[model samples]
Target: MRIGYFLSSEEYTPAELIEQAKGAERAGFSALWISDHYHPWVDAQGQSAFVWSIIGALSQATTLPITTAVTCPTVRIHPAVIAQAAATSAVLTGGTFRLGVGTGEALNEHIFGDAWPEAEIRLDMLEEAIHIMRELWKGGVVSHHGKHYTVENARVYTLPEQPIEVLISGFGPKAVDLAARIGEGFVSVAPDAEMVQRFRSGGGNSRTCQGGFKAAFATSEEEGARIAYEKWPNAGVPGELSQVLPSPKHFEQASQLVTQDMVKKAFVCGNDPEAHLAMIDTYAKAGFDEIYVANSGPHYQGLFDMYAHSVLPKL
Candidate 1:
């Protein structure tokens, strides 16, 4: 399995981001998936840096490939803007960047006072946006008027060595099917055998799977849970409900009903080396070509070391 690291945009500043990216590369991680959220989920999470700039800096910081875990092009930013941004990033990275995109969240998309579109509409918008981006990326003057976007007489001057790959992310079956038809790759938080199968059945290649999971590591399990529930109480929202509840408070409220046992089932929360490796293996077994670990809380350096000694050697 190819191993990668998922960085919380809120958690790291540019210098810290570079240090972590370099560390992951040295530690033998294959690639990096950074998030692009305009707002931190909530202040509990503390920060969400503008992602495009970070990708630009990371191009210089490391040689490992980078992909946005998912950026929403339909709502706040036009696809034309995202196309130009992705093209520029690909050039800066010398063709190592992939633009991973998705139908986004109300939390991020609604911040600009635009109502979040329904899932079906968002999917439609994404398809149209992808069409627009592709035309713009071909390095020629383009005129496009899609149902969701328009661009006229535009061309990317700083061309990439190649076109940026588009990776799509989605959790549900319909969305997964949509990705399979349109994406060069697919990304998801949890690896499910059925979801992988569904993607394959719907047109995604067997080789095009990437999965990520969060693991909490602290000196104390108590410290880890405290941090976990404090920063990500909404995490326990299972299945489709994560689609409806729109605020951090909803997560906090739903989380109050979540037990430590429940949280345990969802993440690796202790410092055990064997335990961490086991957590990573579960996703690999489910058919992920790439497995990304989202390091939890703080103490990132130690978490990386622990994984290197115990978790990584096993993988």
Candidate 2:
């Protein structure tokens, strides 16, 4: 499988993200996955740079393809605006940019005080938003008056030679079906073979399926686990909490029940290249076309170096 690096916007500054992009390129990573978040999961994680600004800077920093691990174009921003931003991004990246989108989480989208829609309603909005974006990308004036959104004679002026590909992120059966029906590709953070098969059977056959996992690279496993827990305790918050929680404080409150061991189990904690490879292999065996690994601690350079020498060379 193609190995890529995931840039966590929630944890790193724009400069750090750009630096990581260059490092990933130099380290021989094939592509990039950058998260689009308005807030850090918790106070400890800290930074949340505007993803578009980082993407623009990344265009100048590296030649590797970049995808928004998932951008929500439904609530915080209008689809028309996202279309323009994504179009400019695709042009800036020399057409190597893909727009990865999903229904988004309340933690990011509830900032406007809008009532958080249920999963089904959010999915409906996402489908309409995608339609609007695709229409705008066709390079003509588009006026859409749909159930969830309205566009009045708006058009995306600066577009790439080809329309940007939309990769949908899905973690459940309904979302996966929507992705198969509309997305050019699929995106996920899990190595679930069942979901991959469901997407293919539902109509995503032959489409690219990309997956990602988090790692905490340090001198040893225990140290890595400590860093992961300190920065990403929310990783252990089970069920729909991730989707429904409205703020970092809310997540922190819910994360109180999460133990360091729970967080460690979710990430490949340590400097062991073999462990990293095993995690990557899980995604590969589950039929992913590409897999991305994201580092949770300050030792991202260490992680990159390990991948460049011990991990990537073997792959």
Number of the top candidate by TM-score? Answer: 2
Per residue, candidate 2 scores C-alpha lDDT tens digits across 1-315 of: 789999999999888999899999999899999999999999998999999999999999999999999999999999999999999999999999999999999999999899999999999999999999999999999998899999998988999998799999999999999999999999999999999999999999999999999999999999999999999999999999999999999999999999999999999998999999999999999999999999998999999999999999998
Residue by residue across 1-315, what tens digits does model 1's lDDT show?
788998888666777878888888877778999988876555677778889999988998899889898898988798989999999999888898988999988767776677767899999999999988888888889898777777888887777978788989888887788888988888888869888888877898764788888777888767776666666665676765555456666656666777766666677676777776776778878878888887757777877887677677777
Candidate 2 lDDT score at position 127: 96
Q: What TM-score, computed on C-alpha atoms, does each candidate reach?
A: 0.93, 0.99
Q: Report lDDT (Cα) of residue 55, candidate 2.
A: 94
lDDT of 2: 0.95
Error of 2 at 185 (Å): 0.8
**For each predicted model, how many residue pairs clash, with residues at least 3 apart or on different chains?**
1, 0
- Estimate the overall C-alpha local distance difference test score of candidate 1: 0.80
Runs in model 2 deviating more than 4 A are: none
